[model samples]
Target: MPRRFWGIRRLLRMPVTEAGDQYSIWVGLIYIFNLIVGTGALTLPAAFARAGWGLSTISLVFLAFMSFMNATYVIETMACANAVYKWKRIQSIKRDSVQDHDDHESDEPSRPFNDMEEPLVCGASIPSRYYSLDRRVELGEMANLFLNKTGRTMFYCTLCVYLYGDLSIYSAAVAKSVMDVVCSTIPANMTNVTDWDALPCFNSSSADPEAYTRMGCYRVALVTFAAAIGPFVFFNVQKTKYLQLFTTGMRWLAFTIMISIAIHLLIGSGAQSRPPAFDITGTPTLFGACVYSFMCHHSLPGLISPIRGKSRLGLHIALDYALISVFYLLLAFTGAFAFAHLNDLYTLNFIPTDNDNLFVKIIEYFLTLFPVFTLSTSYPIIAITLRNNLQSLFLDMTRLESYNFFLRKLLFPVVAVAPPLIVTYFLEDIGILIEFTGSYAGTGIQYLIPTFLVLCARRYCTTLLGLGVVNQYKSPFSNIAWAVFVLLWSFICVVLVSVNIIQKKS
Candidate 1:
């Protein structure tokens, strides 16, 4: 085995061999689907309404295409990292054991997910080294290996900031959703539900309607959200297969219900017959929203690495992304025409808190509070990710193991969870915050990092494995052209968003 094979393994502290566990293609796709289609989708209709149906659709489709392209790059980069191992052990290791392991995993049931474990070593003395489908390479590790300290620092900061924003958005959305539905009961008159910014309705009976405002309820929910989910940040969250399945099921049901209701409303008199054809002012927000909505970049490694079988892996990812694109298109478009004024969170459209129909009221409550069902399951996982990144940023890697475990763990969770909760208290609006978060940090992570990762990996492979070696896991857009374009696009979006923010303030 070549010394280069052990280079990334030592640097990232990852196992050089497989754990004999891999996810089926369907499971992989489902993970990708569930991650992308969350609170982000809830804002699509409003984005479409402002950006215009046509522009919003085009932007979303374009962004989805970009996201998919970047996903391939991430996949290719992971393979390249594994390729270092492959290159190191290529001379000494043989293929018989690897083939047998693949065959064994193929025969296993696909219903329940498999746990990641140490690589199963069998026949060969040096162990079979191959960059097969189930190889795991986390993004942070990739940044460290392929990038300079400066580059790695940039990545860590961008990722942590975006994730903090993400947690904040999730916290606020669930709290607000619960507050909206719980506070507003069946109003005496449902004929005139306006899109006015009203404070939380706090009056119990007819005594004092102005006693409590919506903001006040949101404050309470925000505190409760922190209390319930904030603690999960301190612990390590592994694959909760059942919890994920439960959340994924509820997500599909809620989304399907929203879409069904939207279509029905559009077909009826509730349709916005003359929504703008092209809303130029709305394009920036739409861009941010779409990027936010399509974001699975930070989590792509987790989704792709554990999947079994790599026969035409690129096509599988492409197909998965295409399906998601169509799904988002259908969802955003339906929501656009269904109502005259859509909430930034499209779920709000379905929650007719004061509707006359009993069935409608039931659904309103269901859709309104649906985030609690889904985001609650995800909050801890994301917070943990953010927490880990903060650890990476602050502590020296060499000294990490020697650091005080209690302080190291406790400090990050508090740093990660507390600030976001505090920020959300003052900055109550989810829409504006999501814009800055996605337009800046989201763009860099989803677009810029993948490009650089691939470039660096390519350079590393060419230097180590030589130009003659073929990287089987290479991206279709594996050229400098795509990478350059992504970099430019990311920079342009950031500038545009900044300018827009300034103008709005002025």
Candidate 2:
């Protein structure tokens, strides 16, 4: 019953506005930033080290994969937009027909046909009425209605962007928790270490003279739980326009993030140690990181609406994909070339000691702090999304003003503190957990969702809605081929993660 709650209700009732529409651009930019900076910055170097530094080759493959994925997003966006446009047109026509029928019923009861359907009675359709009255009234009504709807859409879209952004922030928090553990255990140098083969990959290796193995595990578990909260809440919440915006933003953000990660890989300094061919699992930790890096496709659909209007979005998607591929390939090849003979996964074992290297040190420190900032920003958004979802179920729920205050001032800080504190307790080898989660959850959400949505839209919506005629000709088989490509890669991710987990457990 509070004014804020009523405002929410009013938002739901109103249409999207131009001002709201403008926010979409910001949402798009942030989406890109979060995706790039979140986990990609921290994990890509490791992944490259694991891939044996076949950077250019791997980059090409990644680029190709993204290109296919981008194609699907384009198709899905156009299809959904066209469907919405057609639906709106049909509704308008129906409304006009109903109004005409009602007017005729009252004025000329015996008329067999409505005035809207009747042929214009020759010259009787006067210039005064035809040119001014009816046309002006109808146009004005439509203009007003459209403006109102636009405002509502913008509000909902902004809300969705906030929610998705929180998800990205949570990912960053997970990384921070891992880095905290890693930094705490590993020594400044492991130059004298010779028995690298016997080192514990998941715990502290000889590299970490003061390894806190037990502490790291506990921290990993706590951060995992904290990170899980956002997605859990998202799934439980009823889908709204805001939710849609979140989803779309996620997709575009993932694309942009991939590009940024790739760029960093090409230009970023090399790590000092070489990755082992096999860890406990047949694949190296770096490989796991790469797989994880690509796992964020689930968030792409949210961008579909905004990108549907112009072909520019498609071009943007392509460019980003191409760049990411190049970046990854460089990481893979350079990492391998730099340290193929070494047994360690991290290139720079001196990171802990070389605090004087301002650039690397700054990035490392920032990575540690980022999660704190991101988590703080994210918590309130998640709370609000959860609150909105639960409002109907809890009819007598606390007022929005009260809930907002509690969430912002109390719940957020508490939730934020819980992870870092819990992680502080057994904080060694936390990076593995982060890698595993990224590979499993991130890949599923980032790549799989867009691929599936696009394929599904092409298959069902294309034929059902006659989209083929409007767009260029592409066979159903061709569409299915694209889907199969995505499905295959997604399956690889599953296999990669599953095998890694099984190996780790054993």
Candidate 3:
């Protein structure tokens, strides 16, 4: 009824969008939260244990900030890509850029809903001069727009590597979780279990881990993991609404149980308090693990695109990062103190003893099987997404539109799932797998690609927009200096990791 009250309400309400396009900001934030807390988190306690609490804390906080910066750059580039497309659309007098809200294709420019994404709408009549946002310009399309063939190839290769590593790790984690749960019981003391001791049958880590890989309960578990998940690859992997709901519930429950137990142990005699202030030798592995854990940059488009009102979008992302950083610190710190022998999988440390109360045993069983079910569901979703990415990498989408069934049905899916499955069949050790994946591919995807894309996007935007068209969704760190900073950091990380690997081999 009052104009002042109405103004305040508008500010508080989510930015207005078409009714069909609207989703609560909370909904989008939850999706991002889930993405942040995945299988990589299971390894953090071990990483912290190795690197020491102080080093791990500092590295994680700094890496989280870097990740947030690059994510903004990705979004800025999306807007830039859309701006370039819109500029071309006006020049050609081509397909009405505003006609179809959904078809913000790779080569095309589309308008942000209500121009809400623009930093400042000048009320200028010329369409190309105004700010724009395009949700459809995903990371792959951004590379294609800004990068040469060599760069695009490098990006996709690294992306595929990360995806393959993800699937391999997921498969191994699920099998390992299952094997650990079914094949052995926790001792009466609830002491932490070592990989050697947890092994149902195998022995000698110095021996080739795969020498008897086909024998015993791990083999059965691996087969079961494959049997249960492998078939989903051949079909379209649509997101299951209710299944996600169930998994979300399971995730929060598992998290609560874990941190609760960790804190419980820390408050009692179980806390060992043995971490060094810092461990320089372990920093390389810590670097890789931190990079791997903060990996939401590659998937930012899909997560940010669906939010109803993106008003103060940057704040939302910052808030997400803040919450994630705090949560990771809590888990890592509590875990570092709770178990004297922290294994790579934090859940392994929480196995219930024969003397524990019924409640604690239930918690232990839940923790043991947590990764089994979580990673199992996630494996197929990731495999199918990778299959689609692989197809896009090699084939033109226009050609695939009218193509025959053979390439679409048989070849793509097999090519996608086979490598990771094969890796899982042989490589059972997740620690090495995570390190290798995170060090090389993880750095490339998280840093190099985004940094290079934003630099190109900034240059291309100036040339295309003639320096007058403002982009409202520009990154706060939209400077060449910041880009160079990211590049230098990534380069140093690679050099260090390479040296570390060489020394180990020597």
Candidate 4:
């Protein structure tokens, strides 16, 4: 409010187009927070148990920072895309100046502007209204704008792979959760029921035809899950407002109850098992899981576009990452130390025991079915996304009218749903699925895509708008060296994960 503070205010504030309905920056922050914290968080405690708490903590913090940096890269590219759009609009107006001279007064060279408001071309200031992060340019559009044919194909390939893996993980996790809740009895000792034990879901001495091994029960649940949820793939469905609210509430409430229960256990049992400080055997899986945990770059544009004020957006995002990192540490640490044996699916740890009271049993049952409630809602959305992208890869957009109804609709959805469903039958290990998915496809989305997007955007912006203009939302790691570091890091992660997989197989 003072003259001296005007510079500070200007530096901190960026104004988008005056749309009265736009949400506040705080809403955008919450959207991002929700986006980053998803199914990946469920796998973290198991990753911690394997990797050791010391290594998990250090790796998670570093990965969160890397993820934050790339998220800023995504935002910076969005602004650059908007700037390119503005430049093209100006060019189009300039070409029509003779016929619409009076209406195009804003394009007149006589207008005055500050140095920061004009772009330099050949050392000359080209005056125009400043661009803002108002336009919603999705990642696919950005790929088209900045990348060539090969790069776009690679982008879609990696994206579709990640989505397929996502659906597979969702399928297995939900089925596993259901199997545990339905098949598992309240054992006298809670730690006795291992995930892969050969125990039958029904009594071994029973004469019932429905009796089956635990693994068979899991397969049955997987089939049942597909039968119930797979039809949504055939029909278009969206996550409604209430559905989102329900899932978000369930997620946080479950996490709260889990951490509370874990703390209670620690206090009661005096730490059942002391976890190691570091373990190399778990690092590969931990790397993949952490990469998956911080994944929100692909969806950043949709979340960040509607904020009315984007001033200090980078700082706001940094704050979100800070809070998320701390929350992750808290969750993983509490779970790592509480139980002698942690389940790959953290929710399994809360399965009710024969000794627990009625209220505790109810809570434990709720926790055990948590994945079913949440991932069940998510499965169709992801399947539909993968279907659309798979169609995009195979079908030509220009000839959509020529394609048949079955080709357009039925084929892609079946292609999307069937493979992941089939995979769930063979690969019952959710952790291994997570490790493969997050290590390969997750790395591409989280690290390499953002790295290349920023590089191409910077080069294109310099050529289109010249060097005088700055991307206000540019990443703090805006140097070639950082790009190189990210690339190298991705390569090393792939190598390590691959070696780990090979070792396990041999």
Q: Best by lDDT, which number? A: 4
Instruction: Give the TM-score of each candidate.
Output: 0.77, 0.51, 0.78, 0.77
User: Candidate 4: what lDDT?
Assistant: 0.75
lDDT of 1 by residue, 15-53 (tens): 433545555767667766667777777777787888787
lDDT for model 2 comes to 0.41
Root-mean-square deviation of each candidate, in angstroms? 9.4, 13.2, 8.8, 7.3
In model 1, which regions exceed 4 Å deviation? Answer: 1-22, 85-135, 184-201, 205-220, 226-238, 310-312, 391-415, 425-432
Give candidate 2 regions above 4 Å deviation.
1-17, 23-30, 63-71, 74-89, 92-96, 105-287, 301-309, 329-436, 440-443, 459-464, 467-478
True lDDT of residue 52, candidate 3 = 89
- Between 2 and 3, whose TM-score is larger? 3
Q: 240 in model 3: Cα distance from truth in Å?
A: 3.6
lDDT of 2 by residue, 245-313 (tens): 454454344334434443455456453465544343334454455553433232332333332223344
For candidate 3, which ten residues in a row score worst on lDDT?
A: 1-10
Which residue segments of model 3 deviate by more than 4 Å?
1-23, 86-134, 185-220, 223-238, 373-381, 398-414, 426-432, 499-506
Cα lDDT over the full model 3:
0.71
Q: Distance from true position, residue 437, model 1, in Å?
A: 0.9
